[model samples]
Target: MYPFLRMVKELIKFRNAPAMRVGDIHISEHRCWPWDIDLWAELNNGRTLTLYDLGRIPLAQRAGLVSVMRKNGWGMTMAGVSVRYRRRIRTFEKIEMHSRAVCWDDKFLYLEQSMWKKNGECANHALYRSAITDASGIVAPERVLSAMGHSAQSPEPADWIKRWIEADAARPWPPMQDKR
Candidate 1:
């Protein structure tokens, strides 16, 4: 089930946060709840991804991206992701989430986020490709930035992210048919 209550709590917690630039980092604290654990008694991989949202939404809010979306009737969606889980996160363990926008391409924005343990070890990290959409289709990142009252000029995406995008582009859309 979606943690709508938690969502509201986080939203309210960061509501008054100062606006941030695209590359500015947003730090958030969270705990691994019992319900968030899996059979092995660690934070579930799926749950980890969902928990990332708690960090990202606040990032968008602080960056004023949410305001742009609201004003322009635009929406944001996850187009792709590459995540690495480095360590186990035990139940009730506290984590610090760090999130920031890396850069933007013609049609997508790239973001990087990480969950860190109190000992300074990284538990997980992810690179995300997000698209802004409206009634027509994907909106250009420059346009989205403009709507957010930001400069149209965008920094180039990281080489690794650019490689991933290229790899994704080469993949077959419908996939191979099963030879049953």
Candidate 2:
């Protein structure tokens, strides 16, 4: 089951947080519970993605993207993501998470998130490409930002992000059909 209750708690907790502009970081902390563990007694890999929502959703609300989406009848969805997990997160251990929108292009918005242990080790990091959608199709990110009151052009993407975008472009769509 999804952690719907935990997500609601986070929403309520940040209901009045100071509004953040594009690119500002939103920080929060969370603990791993027994249900979050895998056979190795560590936080499950898939759960890490779900836990990220606890931060990402609040980040969106704080940045007013949620409001913009609601007002315009837009929906947001992840188009792609890359995550690196270097350290193990054990059950009952607390981690600090940092999340922020990095930049965007006409087609997609980018965001980054990370989790850190108390001793200052970065346990994991993820880069996400997302899109705003309506009934017709994907809505341009620039249009979404305009609706959110941010008119500035996107900051230059980092070299790694640029490389990733390039690399991903070479991957075939509707992948792996030949094997069947």
Candidate 3:
């Protein structure tokens, strides 16, 4: 189930927070609740993705993207992602999540996010490719940026993210047509 209540809490909690500059990092803290645990007694892999939303949406808000999207009838959606889970997060454990936009191209925005344990260990990290969309289909990142009152020019992407994009582009789309 989506954590709607948590999202509302985040929104209200940060309502008066200062807005962040474009490409700046947004940080937030969260706990691994009992309901967030897997049978292995650690944070569930799927739930981790959902929890990332707790940070990403606020990041968007701080960037003023959410307001622009609302005014323009645009929506944001994840087009692809790569995640690494390097450490375990036990129930009741607290973590600090950091999120930022790494770069953007004509088509999509690339974001990097991570979670760190209070003890200073990195628990997980992820790279995401997201698109802004309208009724017509995917809206160009340039257009989205312009609507948000920013210049259309994006920073150069890092080599690793460039490689990941190239790799993803080479993958076959609409995969797995054959019976298992």
Candidate 4:
């Protein structure tokens, strides 16, 4: 058995340890600082949490998740991300964010996450996909499986690889200009 398999077996035993959650949003208290205002202001005419600040929650959560996998002797690299904002948040408003792993295939792991206002309304949602890799950043498929406590010949297949490739091909070169 691969050394990493032991860690995977342990993780599986406590797989449902807990639902990961994070965050609390802070709205603007003053408008004197234009630079700060510009950074936080949203297209919907409400102040937003700066990307720098909003990013902290996910960064910490990702670090924690990565630590879990690493402790199991598994390493991974982030591959793609998609975020959607549902409602405009203004100053003095509070929002809560939550994150959790939904599933994983042979090559990629999928995370489902969300943000909500104090009122319990969803403010945003996001999905993060990551690829398993080796210390050298090489895609070692069989190694990844073994690290996850699966047999080297596990039947799991990677469907996202094709989709990621096709999406890369179809992506536009540059974003469209805003006429306003």
User: Which candidate's TM-score is highest?
Assistant: 2
Give the per-residue lDDT digits (tens) of candidate 2, residues 1-180: 799999999999999999999999999999999999999999999999999999999999999999999999999999999999999999999999999999899899999999999999999999999999999989999999999999999999999999998898899887876565
Q: Write the per-residue lDDT of candidate 3 for residues 37-149, one digit (tens) a residue.
A: 99988999999999999999999998999999999999999999999999999999999999999899878999999999998999999999999999999998888888888
Clashing pairs in 1: none
Clash number by candidate, in order: 0, 0, 0, 2
Residue-wise lDDT of candidate 1 within 1-180, one digit each (tens)? 776778789899999988899889999999999999999999999998899999999999999999889988999999989999999999999999999999888889988999999999999999999999999999999988887878847777778888988999899988999999
Q: Answer with 1 or 4, whichever has the higher lDDT.
A: 1
Q: On lDDT, who's better, 2 or 3?
A: 2
**Candidate ordering by TM-score (highest first):** 2, 3, 1, 4
TM-scores of the models, in the order given: 0.96, 0.98, 0.97, 0.46
Query: Which candidate has the top score in lDDT?
Result: 2
Where is model 2 more than 4 Å wrong at Cα? 178-180
Which residue pairs in candidate 4 collide?
Answer: 27-92, 28-91
TM-score of 2: 0.98
> Candidate 1, after superposition: displacement of residue 63 in Å?
0.7
Which residue ranges in model 3 land beyond 4 Å of their true spot? Answer: none
lDDT of 4 by residue, 1-180 (tens): 122442344345434444332222222111122332334553232222223123323333333544545665655556666667787555545555555444455566555555566677877665666566666564554454454444435333236634654575598767688899
Off by over 4 Å in 4: 1-68, 71-75, 138-180
TM-score for candidate 1: 0.96
